[model samples]
Target: MTDLVQQAGIKLDATASSPEEAVDICGKLLVELGAITSSYADAMWEREQIFPSAIGMGFAIPHGTDESRAHVIFDQLVFVRLAKPISWADDEVTCVLGIASQGDGHVELLGNLAEMIQDEDKLAILQNSDNPEEIAQLLLGND
Candidate 1:
């Protein structure tokens, strides 16, 4: 699971004017990590249009559509913390977790994220910590 979120995958001090821009930045990080092709980025935005990804606690997990799975090369997660909050649908979001997975991996990833965010201490680090290693540890656990 640690491999899913390398230090490079964690980006901080980012800025975005809108959800679209935020998603784009997330997609670009996944592409840079060679997790998915460019088309998958568009799919993520499409998914956002049909259903917003903002799950609360200032976080939004965006992923590509099922059809966009063809563009995925491997499972990967990109964490982006914006310098300021952006309006994501009805909620405000400062953290974006960009997911690139081809199969049930995404389900598992979502489950882990759901559970992690439930812990207020961990969620606070993910939201406020500037240290990439700390954020990665929070996401992947003490291991």
Candidate 2:
């Protein structure tokens, strides 16, 4: 939990207009939370074109790796909750995970997050939680 807290923060949205809009909104939150550089937001949008971050199961994981950005080892992680469903592939996602990584090390972290996200039980726990800290602890097994 401490590890995730060290890297990511959570933000609330009173109203998230749409799925694409949610991605843009989440990127802004990551920048404002200091989890990622503001410039990296562009890279994230580009990546979204090649691959949809909407991994289904009410989750969307977006990432960006640009040299112009901070390019830190741990990168950054941020959670975004939408007021309504957003189109992703054939599904609608409500929670978004905005991630930014600089090097190969992040692959392992990303894999772990991906696995955790795939688990229906885990995802349920996270969605039902009130804040990111609880979700982080759930993922980190800090509880």
Top model by lDDT, which number?
1
- After superposing candidate 1 on the true structure, give the runs of residues whose Cα lies further than 4 Å from its correct spot: none
Which regions of candidate 2 fall more than 4 Å away from where they truly are?
1-3, 6-8, 12-14, 65-74, 141-143
Q: After the best TM-score superposition of candidate 1, give how far the Cα of residue 135 lies from its true spot, in angstroms.
A: 0.9
lDDT tens digits by residue: candidate 1, 1-143 = 66888899899989999999999999999999999999998899999999999999889999999899999998999999999999998899999999998887767667877888888877888888989998887777662
Each model's lDDT: 0.89, 0.66
| Best of the candidates, TM-score | 1
lDDT string, candidate 2, 1-143, tens digits: 24544324665443665655776876776676665666677677777877887876778887774563564334566677676667876778888777766655455655776787777777776676676667766655554
- Report the alpha-carbon TM-score of model 2 versus the true structure: 0.77
TM-score of each: 0.94, 0.77
- Native-to-model Cα distance after best TM-score fit, residue 132 in candidate 1, in Å: 0.7
